[model samples]
Target: MSAKVSAGKQVFAIVKKDVLAELRTKEMVIAMFLFVVLAMVVFSQAFGVILNDLDRVGGGLLWVAFLFMSMLGLNRSFVHEKDEGCLEGLLMSPIDRPLIFFGKMLGNLLFLSIVELFAVPIFFVLFRLEMGASMAGIFLATIFLSNIGIACVGTLLSTISINTKTRDLMLPILFMPVIIPLLIAAVSATGGIMSGEELTEVYGSMRFIAVYDIIFLLVAYALYDYVISE
Candidate 1:
């Protein structure tokens, strides 16, 4: 019990340190937010007629923005640690490797969610997208579910890429192929919500996302120690 408690505290400490660092530097989060907003604005201007059928296409556009934004954020997730020489120290610390993975993964998740919250309203405004409040809960739930898989898979792969010579280039290559399944489910769920499709299909997509997140979480838990040590 005490061991579990200590591990929990370490994870929270990792998260808190990341939050404080982001507040100070304001680099990663700011860049992600800007990328998302600008992408949408540009699309709206250049593809106005195409965007008219938002209900059908908006979900794809939203995922494209988020997928890239996630890549930007995930690419930077470990920059501070790697550049400041903290990665070595973090690995050497007494905290369990699993804890470090969770800590970093949770931090990534939080930052991504924050950017999404701000970006989505702007997306709604620019695109004139709407859904009944009855559907709002499902809409938000779908996004949050997808975020889990994004954070989970992104963080695990990031640990590998951060140590590479071509870290930036390596991440997308590793991330893209692995992330396709999750992206499909996410787009399906959100597109269903936007199109006011039946609830059952949305629920099915959400379930698949939930399973994907769980599988990745377990994979990360099992492999992080080995991955981070190398």
Candidate 2:
């Protein structure tokens, strides 16, 4: 019980530290927000104005924007720590390494969620899409589940890529393939919701995402210490 409490405190401390630093700088969130908007504009133009097939393609476009925006944010998630030598200091601290992983994952999740809150509405408005009441809940659920998986795997890869000389170039390369399964599940589930499918229709994709989140989260948690050590 005491160990769990200590771990919880350590996690909170790291989260607080990162959040405070981000608030001061406002770098990652701003960049991600702008990138999301630009991607939306570009995608909107490429697809042009769709009259009938919006549901079929909207989900793919939405997740594409999320995928790139997340990569941009994940690439920077560890750069500041590496630049400031904070990564070393944190590693030397008495806190457990998995707690550090959780802290960083949560920080990334928070930033992504904030960006999505703004992005999703803008996406719906720009695409002239409307969601039924029931679909709204499922759409939000899909976003939450997908973000968890992205944050888990992205955090681990970010740590690994940060140590490389071409971290900026290497992160997306390492990140994209690992997240392909997640992107597929997210796009499928979201597309189903947008198409007004019944909850039962999208359950399979939802289950895949949940399983992906659990599996990668555990894998990342187990492997994080080694990733950070080197």
Encode model 1's per-residue lDDT on 1-230: one tens digit a residue: 34445888889999999999999999999999999999998888888898879998899899989989999999898998899899899888788899999999999999999999999889998888877787888888888889999999999999899989999889999998999999999999999989988989989999999999999999999999998996
Quickly count the clashes in candidate 1. Answer: 0
- Clash counts for the predictions, in order: 0, 0
- Cα RMSD, each candidate: 1.8, 2.1
Cα TM-score of candidate 1:
0.96
Local distance difference test, each candidate: 0.91, 0.90
lDDT of 2: 0.90
State which candidate has the highest lDDT: 1
lDDT of 2 by residue, 1-230 (tens): 34445788889988898889889999989999999999989987777866348889899999999999998998888888899898999888787788889999999999999999899999999888999776788898899899999999999999988888898889889989999998998998999988877777689999999999999999988898898886
Candidate 2: deviation at residue 169, Å?
0.8
